[model samples]
Target: MITGGSSGIGLSVAHDVARRGASVTLVARNVSRLEKAQQEVELTMSKLSMDGKVQFFSSDISGSVKNISEMVKNAEASLGPVYMLINCAGFARAQKFEDLSPDLMKQMLDINFTGPMVLTQEVVRGMKVQQEGGVVVFVSSQAGLLGLYGFSAYSASKAAIVRAAEALHMELKPHNISVTVCYPPDTDTPGFVEENQTKPIETKLISEAAGLFKPEEVAKKLVDDSLCGAWSSTVGLEGFMLTTLCAGMGPITDAASFMAQVFLSGLFRSVSAFYLWSFTRIVEREHKKRLENKKSE
Candidate 1:
């Protein structure tokens, strides 16, 4: 089951898993997009000559608990118990701390953090009972690792997912359940385009340092890492550095990740200091420009 599976990285993940002959259910709020995504998955399955089912569920993950529970029940009824639950149904709204409204903050927490938590709770109950266990993937962002300008609320929400997934990883390890948190860099998605429109100058410049990635690339990496039960799924050199630097007592799923984090912490710390300095300089320059414009006005 892939939430936010209507489009973007989520849809691409649906395609990736479908290629592996996994029965998939695309979950999102848009019925039309879900229909289209379902058709796409079906096409993928057809090409591979796989017999697994492709389904879609139109429901808001951030809505009432009862509704979300029912949606899970219906989904599982259609496609059997969810073996993998990818919590990808989230959005980003770039706004400065001062510009963030109360409603906007609440909405970010609701959709990005609480929604995934609630859905995972519902699905995890059944996953515990299944003998084969399961896998859970949470799609967080690089912003979650390091808070940046114009992402005050968005970073908080995504960070919450990271911490929550850590706690969950400990709890579910005994049950043979694996929890993976995917920290994707800026991917070329519809959501990314929308988010860029409202980004502050500092945010835009600081984020551009990471470079953009294709959704298919991100999705493939996410799927591969989750299937391998890797604790943190990311892409590129910078992603590796961030994940290693920010991995604070997270589940040590592999010896290689542990070794890298142990040996590279100091080096990454030095590198991150430089990045932080650059980001601060950008923010300072932008603030100076704004003050100059205000004085002229």
Candidate 2:
């Protein structure tokens, strides 16, 4: 079962899963979108093979844990117990600290991290009961590994998943259920575009320097990693750069990781300064304009 399976990485995973000859159960909001996605997945699967089925439950899995349980039960009844679970249902939003509220932060956590973890719990319980163990993948982000400015909420949510997956991977090993947390760089998806909207100028400047990924490339690596029963994976070369960046360079390699960190942070600081300086200039100009208007009056 794939959550947020209607689009982006989730949708891409759906196609990959079906092509691998697994019947898919897609969970997401928007009935029409799911239906459309289901059709596309099936069509692609058919081109790849003669036998594959696609199904979907069109409701918000982010609403509650109970809904997730019920939906999984319904899906099991139709698909004969899911053999895999991909926690890909997440969204991104960004804004300055002054503009975002507590509720919005919670919503970010609930959907991006909480929703996936809670929903996974429901699915894994079934796998445990049946003892028919399978694979589970958490689609985390590089942002989860390193703190990026303007991503306090998003980063926290992702960091939680990375830690959770590492812990769970150890716990679930005895059950023969493989757990993998995958981190990918910015992919060319609507979600990425949406996130760019609220991206702080600092983050945006860094993002502009990033190498954009096509969703298919990310999906391919993910499917391969899941099949290989990996405990953790970084989905691309860009991801590897992030891994190195996070690992921190040492004296043997003479790697200036501290410098790297500073370099990255400087990019953001510069943009932040730009915005602040611009705002200051605008206000000063406005004040001058007002004083001149008063003199004219």
Candidate 3:
């Protein structure tokens, strides 16, 4: 079961899962898009000649727990027990701290962090009862690892997911349930496009350093890492460096990752300092330019 499965990374994950011969239940708020995504997944199933069923439930992830629980119950009834629960339904709105509204902050917390956290609670209850352990994935962001300019609210929400997933990884380890949190870089998605519109110049410059990725690429890595029971899922060289550098007290899913984090910590710190310096320069330059324009006015 994938939330936000109607479009973007969520939809891409649905296609990948469908091709793997797994029955899928897509959850999203847009009924029309959900219908289209269902058709797309069914098409993938047909091409693979898989007998897996495809269904969709249109609902908001930020809605009440009662409604979310019902959504899960109905999904399982249609597609059997959920072996994997991927929380991919989230959005971002980049704005400077002073420009943000109280409502926007609450919305960010509700949709990005609380919604997935609540849904995970419902799904894990059944997962623990079933003999087959489950995989729970949270799709966080690169900004979650390091705060970025113009992403005050957005970064805070995504960062919360990372911390929660870390605790969950420990608790669910004994239950044979692996929780993976994926920190995807700027991906080419509808949400990313919308987010860019509100981004400050400094934020754009700093974020561009990480480079953009495709939804399919991010989805593939996310699904692969979750299935492998890897605690941290990330893409690109920058992503590897960030995850490794910020992997303090995180679950050591593999010996290799642990070794890399241990050995490369110093080198990554040196690199991060350079990156931080450049980001500060960008912010100062932008501020100066705005001030000059105001003087001219």
Candidate 4:
């Protein structure tokens, strides 16, 4: 089951996973978009010559927990037990911290953090009942790893998921269930386009350094990592470095990654300081430019 499966990374993952012969149930708020996504996934499955059922459920994930639980129950009734739950339905509203409204902050928290947590709770209960462990994937952002200009609310919401995933990993490990949280850099998606409209110049400049990724590329890496039971899935070198540097209290089951984290954490921290300094300079320069323009006017 994939939330936010109607578009962006979620839809892309639906295609990839369906092609690999896994039935998928896409959950989203827009009925029309979900229908289109279901058609797309089915078409792709046919092209790949893989027989997998593709279904969709339209529900506002930020709604009541009972509603979300019912949605999952219906999905399981149709598709059998959910072996994987992907929490991908989220959005970002980037703006200066001072300019953000309390409502916007609450909405961001509800959609990005609470929605996923609620859905995960429902799915995990089912997994426990069946006594068949499953994989849970959270599509967190690079903003979650590091705070940036114009992303105060977004970063806070996403950062919560990373910590929550860590706690879930430890608690569910005994049940044979594993959790994977992906830290994807900015990707080319409808959400990214919308986010860019509100992004400050400094935020854009700082974010561009990480480069943009395609939804398909991000989805492939995310699905593969989740299937492999990786604790964290990072898109590129920058993301990998951030994950290693921010390896706070998560479960690091891979010996190679653990050794690398131990050896390179300090080095990465030094490099990250330089990056942060550059970002700070950009913010200062942009502010100065704006002030100068205001004075000239």
Candidate 5:
């Protein structure tokens, strides 16, 4: 089962997984997008399986109890056993500390952390009872590990995922269930590009400084890493360092902590600048190539 499987990294992961003879059950919010994604998956999986059956279930993740439960049941019925769960349905919202609101924070948490956690519980029940046990993957971000200029809510939500994944991994170990948490650097998704156009000046500058990742490449590596069930899989250098620094956020505070925050923030800004510049250029080139292709067609 793959949540957020309608677009971006989730779709890519779904496409890859269905090829390895895994019957993919895709979950997302938009019915049309899910249909399109399922088609793409079916088209790709055809080369690998002559009888692969893929299913799609659409639901918004903002706490839909009955609908979500039904979707899972239907999906399990359509496919076979639910042995693996890849949680990729998530997004980052850019907001300064000043603009942050309680509602917005909850919104971020509900989708990025709470939804995945709930879905994991549901799947774990099935896997546990069936005695087949399973693996769980959460598509977290480097934002969770490191603080960015204007990602307070986003980072907090993602950070929660890391902690949640770790705890869940430990608990599920007794049931032979492996939980894999992933952190990918800035990737060349339409979401990233759209964000760059309107994010804070500081965020834009910081993001520009940090290097960017390709969605396809990141997607491939992320799914592979998840299947391998490593403790943690960070896709880039910046993400790795941030993960290390975030380890001691609770213990560090006061004047010394303030200084450390300043230093770390500066370091983050510096590193992100290079990433932003390189990735923005890549997107620009790709955008132009796409325009040319459309004109020719």
Candidate 6:
């Protein structure tokens, strides 16, 4: 089961996993978009000649706990017990802290944080009852690791996901359930396009250094990591360094990864300080330019 499975990373994951013969239930809000995504998934399955069932549920995941619960129940009933639940239905509205509206903040928390939490609760209940164990993947962001100038609300919401997944990892391990949280850098998606419209100059400049990734690339890595029961999934060198630096009490199931984290974390931290300084300079320069323009006016 994948939330936000109608597009972006979620939809790509659906295609990759389905190609690997996993039945998928895509949960999204727009019926038309869901239908379109379902068709795309079906086409992929056909091309791969994989016998995988693809279904979709059109419902607002952040709206009601009861409704989401019913939706999950229905999905499992139709698609069989969900072996994996990927929380990928989220959006970002980048703006400066002073410019962020109250409603927008609430919306971010509701959609990015609360929605996934609620859906995971509902699905995990079934996972526990079945006693078969399962995988829960949370699609967090790079901002979740390090807060950025224009992403106050978004970073807060995504940061919640990282901590929640960390706690869930410990709790679910006894039940044979594994939780993997992915920290993906900016990806080429509809959400990224929308986010860029209001993204602060500092935020944009800082993130650009990390580079953008394709949804398919991120999805493939996420799926493979989750299947391997990795505690954290990251893409590229930047992502790996950030994950290691910010790991902080999070589960480290792989010895080699742990060793890398311990050895490279300090070096990365020193390198990150330079990036932090550069971002601070950008913010200050932008602010000064705005002030000078106001004075001229």
Q: Candidate 5 lDDT (Cα, whole model)?
A: 0.76
Backbone clashes counted, model 6? 0
**What TM-score quantifies how close candidate 3 is to the native fold?**
0.99
Count of clashing residue pairs in every prediction: 0, 0, 0, 0, 12, 0
lDDT for predicted candidate 3 compared with the true structure = 0.93
lDDT of 1 by residue, 1-297 (tens): 999999999999999999999999889988999998999899999999999999888999999999999998998888899999999989999988999999999999999999999999999998987556999999999989978889989999999999999999999999989999999999999999999899887888998998999999999999999999999999989999999999988999899999999999999999989999989999899899999999999
Candidate 4 whole-model C-alpha lDDT, 0 to 1: 0.93
Q: Can you write out model 2's per-residue Cα lDDT over 1-297, one digit (the tens) per residue?
A: 888888898898888878888899988888888999999998988798748788999767668778778888899998777788888888777676678799989988998887888888888888888756789899888888766667788888988887787778777778888887778788888789888877866566555445688888888788887777864456565465564455332111123534545466545545556645655565466568888999999
- Report the lDDT of model 1 for residue 158: 97
In Å, residue 153's CA in model 3 sits off its true spot by: 0.9
Model-by-model lDDT, in order?
A: 0.93, 0.77, 0.93, 0.93, 0.76, 0.91
CA lDDT, candidate 1, residue 44: 92
Runs of candidate 3 with Cα error greater than 4 angstroms are none
Worst 10 residues of 5 by lDDT: 248-257
Over 12-113, each residue of candidate 6 has an lDDT whose tens digit, in order, gives 999999999999999998899999999999999999898899999998878988999899889988888888999999999988899999999999999999
lDDT of 4 by residue, 158-227 (tens): 9999999999999999999999999989999998999899888899999999999999999999999999
Model 4 regions lying over 4 Å from their true place: none
How do the residues 56-102 of candidate 3 rate in per-residue lDDT, one tens digit apiece? 99989899999999998988887778899999999998888999999
Error in Å for residue 186 of model 4: 0.4
User: Per-residue lDDT of 2-63 in model 5, one digit per residue for the tens?
Assistant: 88888888888887777777788888888999999988999988876546678888787657
In model 5, what lDDT does residue 83 have? 87
Q: Which is superior by lDDT, 1 or 5?
A: 1
List the candidates' TM-scores in order. 0.98, 0.81, 0.99, 0.98, 0.80, 0.98
